[model samples]
Structure formats: C-alpha cells, structure tokens
Target: MAGVRAGFSTDLGGRLNVEPEVRAVVDATATVFTDLGATVDDACIDLLDAAEVFFTQRAYDFAAWYGPSLHARPESFRDFVAWNIEVGLGLTVDDLLSKDAARVRLAVAVDDFFTDHDALVTATSQVLPFDASWDYPRSINGVPQEDYLDWMRAATLISSTGCPAVSVPAGFARPAGVPDAPELPVGIQIIGAPGRDVEVLRVAHAVEAATGHGRRHPDL
Candidate 1:
C-alpha cells in the first residue's frame, strides 16, 4: 500500500448490501439512543445529508464509469450501482445543485478541521456489539435486505473531504449485552486532510505508542 499515492475504498459499491439483521440491530440501537435522549443534533443530520453527495461524487463515481459499466457488471455489483444511479436521477435540478454545493462545503469543513492539527481521530465503531457468524446480504423474515449504508457512515463521511484516514488498534471493548462474548479489539481511525497521509500515519503511531494496543493480542 506504500507508494507515491495510496488509494482507499469507501462503502464498497456505495451500499454494503448487508443482511436484514444488521438493519434490525441498527434500528434497535437507534431506538435505544432515542429513548435515552441521545438524539442527534441538526448539524449532524446536515452532515449526513452532505456526506451522501460527497461520497458519491468522490468515491462512488470518481472515475465517471457508473453509467455504462453498471449495465455490464455482475448482478451483485450492478444492483448497488443501479440503485445509486436511480437515486441520482430522481433528484431535481435544484437538488443536484444543492448536492454540488454540499460537496464544496464538505471540502472546506475538512480543511478547517485539520487547519492546525496533525490528524483527527475517532472510535472505529460507535457500538460494542458484534456477531461473529453474521453473514452479508442476510435474510430477515424471508427476503434479503441489501441496503446497509450505515456500516461505513463515519469513514465514508470523512472520505467526502478527500482526506486520508488510517485505522489502528486502539484496544478491546467489553460486550454490552452478551456476558459470554470475548473482549473485542477496536480501532482508532486517524484522519488527515488531502495529501497529509504522512501526518495521518504519524498520529496513528503516536496513538499506538500511547495505548500500546498493538502489543496486545486477543485470545482465540
């Protein structure tokens, strides 16, 4: 991965195509957050709206191959591409313009955040729950649920800024509800503005040294 320039993937095909159980988990988590009065602020909602367009432009259709190639791709890949395309086409002219505007705002936000910093770091996962045997495109009831877009919500949101991000070991998390579950290793993602890959790596190294998480191994 070390080269003059490095590349990263975002929301593989723009939709994770995860099973319905994942969605149910997400919905249940949201309910808990809502009931606990941990509602998301309006600013965060706006950021999510902006992130959709930013990620689509910079990563999903970065090469402008979404149109013709979507038709020729395998059934698995084509569905997500077609879905993204359908969403894009459904937007009004004003909506399209707003998305473009959001892209510019997102770029500026990234620059402003990293203006005086080496990098920005955050927990890799907001929740500590896991299912080791969970399968992708999983079924719920009987039909498969293909839209698991929230899986990379944070990372892809940052990708809209064209910044570089690296995920390094942060430590383990105790399972919230499952008493028998093992302590799961989590990651700390370091994000830096565009062309600041070196700075991102440095920050990751510093976190590793401070936490010494990399030195620890999980029991099998």
Candidate 2:
C-alpha cells in the first residue's frame, strides 16, 4: 500500500444517512491506510443521480429476467420481486434514456476522481446488521426508508458508477447504553476506477492485515 493515494468518504457527501458507528468504521479505515504509507484524504465522486441510474437499470433487468414468469405465475414470487417486475414493465423509453445519460455522467465523474486518487473508501452499509426476520432495515438513523432498496442506497449508488468495489471487515460496533450488547460487525468499502479490480483488492488486503478484524468471528 506504500505511496498509494486513497480517498475516503463516510456518507457520499451526506447524500445518504449513514449511522455514526458505520461512519466511524470507515474513518478508522482511512487511518489504517495512512499508517500503511498511503496518502488518505476525504473525497467522494458526485453520486446525486446514482440511485436513479441504478434503480432504472435494475428495473429494466428485472423485467427482462422475470416478466414472463410474473405473467405466468405471479403467486410464485414475493411482493417486492413482483413489484420490481411491474416497475420494469412500466418503464418508458424516455425514462431509460434519461437514466442512461445520468449513468454516463456518473461514469465520467468516477473516472475523473480516480485520476487523482488510487482508491475510494466508504462505509459498506449505512446501518448495522439487522435481524434475519426483517426484510431490510425500515429506517436508518431514525430516517424512514421508503422501500426495500432504500436501505441499500450506499451500495446501489456505488454500483451505478461501474467501479470495482470490495467490502472488508473494518471493526465492530457495540450498541450504546448496553454494556452486555453483542458487538456488530462493520465494513469498509474499497472502490477503484473501472478495470482497477486488482488495486482495490490490494487496498482491501492491506486493510485486512492492518486491522485483523476479518479474523474475528461472531459468537453464534
């Protein structure tokens, strides 16, 4: 990791409501990079339109992959899956075109960011791991999440950038005011420019070695 220039962003410029614990993990990961002889700074690519791009493209994909099955046996799929297929089926040509344009802008912005930095770091998730019975966290930091995808904006927004990103265990977060509360795992996302998968992995590897968080397993 020596001499590698890395940039870290905890909240995607405050576009996402990241939990304080999650943000702290990413911030700590930035320190790990600096200690590894890499230059770390606060930086984030413009992802304001990333959610739109990702959801639009995903809806299109869902329609292509499941529209036939949905039409044949709607009862076989869950409500959210059926909803996604319906959304895809209802997309207008203009909707796709506009999102495509936005996607292009995001790609360009990510490429530009990488020209100045080797890797981008972010919180892997906006909130801690939730109960298995829940579909997804209904809220993050007291902010209501509108749908299944809302809780996952952190990763989905990055996906729209078409960059290679890897998530590595950063540390653990224990709930506040609960002395005996179990420690929840937190992750740091390491992202690189297009075709820079190896660099991202190298950064992830360095982080794993530095923190040793990956070696710790939860008590089941």
lDDT of each prediction vs. the true structure?
Answer: 0.49, 0.87
Where in model 2 is the C-alpha error above 4 Å?
218-220
Off by over 4 Å in 1: 1-49, 58-82, 88-95, 132-146
Residue 63, model 1: lDDT of: 33
Displacement of the residue 31 alpha carbon in candidate 2, Å: 1.1
- Give Cα distance to truth, residue 66, candidate 2, Å: 0.6
Best by lDDT, which number? 2
Cα error of candidate 2 at position 9, Å: 0.4
Q: Model 2, range 1-220, lDDT digits (tens) per residue?
A: 9989987788887878898877887777777888899998878888878988999999999999999999999999998889999999999999999998998888888888888899888889988888899888888888899878998888999999989999999988876566798989999888898899998998889889888889976754
Clashes of each: 1, 0
